[model samples]
Target: MSEGAKLTVQELDKRFGDGDDAVQALAGTDFSIAENEFVTLVGTSGCGKSTLLSIVAGLEEPTDGSVLVEGHEVEGPGRDRGVVFQAYTLFPWLTARQNVEFALRDEGLTKSDVRQRADQHLRMVGLERFASARPNELSGGMRQRVAIARALSYRPLILLMDEPFGALDALTRQLMQELLTGIWEQHRLTVLFVTHDVEEAIYISDRVLVMTNRPGRIKAEVPVDLSRPRSPEMLSDATFLEPKAQVLEAIREESLEALE
Candidate 1:
């Protein structure tokens, strides 16, 4: 692990079932994410992208090897790591502000402190005005933002996102991506975002990890050299287009082999 690297995964492997029914979701996967850097894992379905994120989030233990956060092994879920899933996991009964406040309850914070902090995060995601709204009343994108605000309120060392924008429509997804990138830049968070969208990965990541078909392992690490504060316009720039093509080619080859 290098100095200032927020997270490290070494020879990580995950398996399910046993014997004839055994499945290897991840095999010999290794990577390091630096402090305050944004990285994305992109691959086809069943490539263990979510499984890998789960291991790093300590939601599931790897069958082999280790995951370390800030130099300490990730034993289980901790405040050091906050996770946002594709679904809006907020309590339906709780208002947006209250949902975010719930995450702070175990932190020994006062109600006033929680409210103040939660409001700050809600504002960060442009949802401050919707704080009193329930999940059922909000749009999909709004709910997702609430989920993110809840995660951010914890002030975790790393934000583990599993296709957080995957459920939204094209326009909403694009807007959410822009919102997320702005938040990431403002906070300098170490974000491990898992997405199947190649263009979204290219737009938001400092480096994109391409995973092989399951028994998943990193097949390539493509660094996004395009200068940031990235906009949709950059998608057409050669710097972005070139790497996007490379990733597409990698995915195409994998798809072809899978059919063989």
Candidate 2:
């Protein structure tokens, strides 16, 4: 592992079933995430992105190899890593603030402490005004923000997001991306986000990790050298378009070959 790497995965492999029924989701996958850095993983569907995240989150154990966080082996899910999924995952019955408060329940905090902390996170995600609203009453984006607040409330060492904005419409997705980048900059949380959207990957990540089709493994790591605090306008700039084109070409070639 490198000196500043906050997380490391080595020789990781995952398989399901047996013999002819067997399927390999990840084959000797390896990668490292530096502390306070935002890294996004991009690939076609079923490329083991979510599976790899599950391993890192300790939601599932790898059939081979290891996952380490802050140089320590990830034995199981801990408060050190928080996850935001594509689904809102907020309790439908619970209000937005209540949902965030629920995450902090296991931290042995006092009731007052939980409320204070939850309120802070909700405000950070710009959902403070909707604190009393239930998930069903919120828009798709608002619900997602609630989910993000719930994750951030735990004050985890890293935030692992699996296409949290994938379910939103185009305009909503754009807004959410900007919101996320702003939050990331403000909090400096180490993030490992999984997305199939190449444009989204390029727009928000410090570095983009491209993976092979199935039995996925890291194919390439492309750093986005554009200036920070990237806006939607940057997408039309030559510097940004060049890297985006390169990544798109790589994905296009891979997809075409997969069809062959």
| Candidate-wise lDDT, in order | 0.92, 0.91
Residue 16, model 2: Cα distance from true site in angstroms: 1.1
**Local error of candidate 1 at residue 83 (angstroms):** 0.4
Estimate, for each residue in 1-260, the C-alpha lDDT of model 1 and write its tens digit.
Answer: 76778899999999999999999999999999998889999887899999999989888999999999988999998999999999889999999999999999998988899999999999999999999999999999999999999998989999999999989999999999999999987889999999999999999989998999999999988999988687999989999998899888887877887889
Assess candidate 1 and give its lDDT: 0.92
Give me the candidate number with maximum lDDT: 1
TM-score of each model, in listed order: 0.98, 0.97
List candidate 2 stretches off by more than 4 Å. none
Top candidate by TM-score: 1
Clashing pairs in 2: none
Q: Distance from true position, residue 179, model 1, in Å?
A: 0.2
Which 10 successive residues of model 1 have the least lDDT summed?
248-257
Q: How far is 104's C-alpha from truth in model 2 (Å)?
A: 0.6
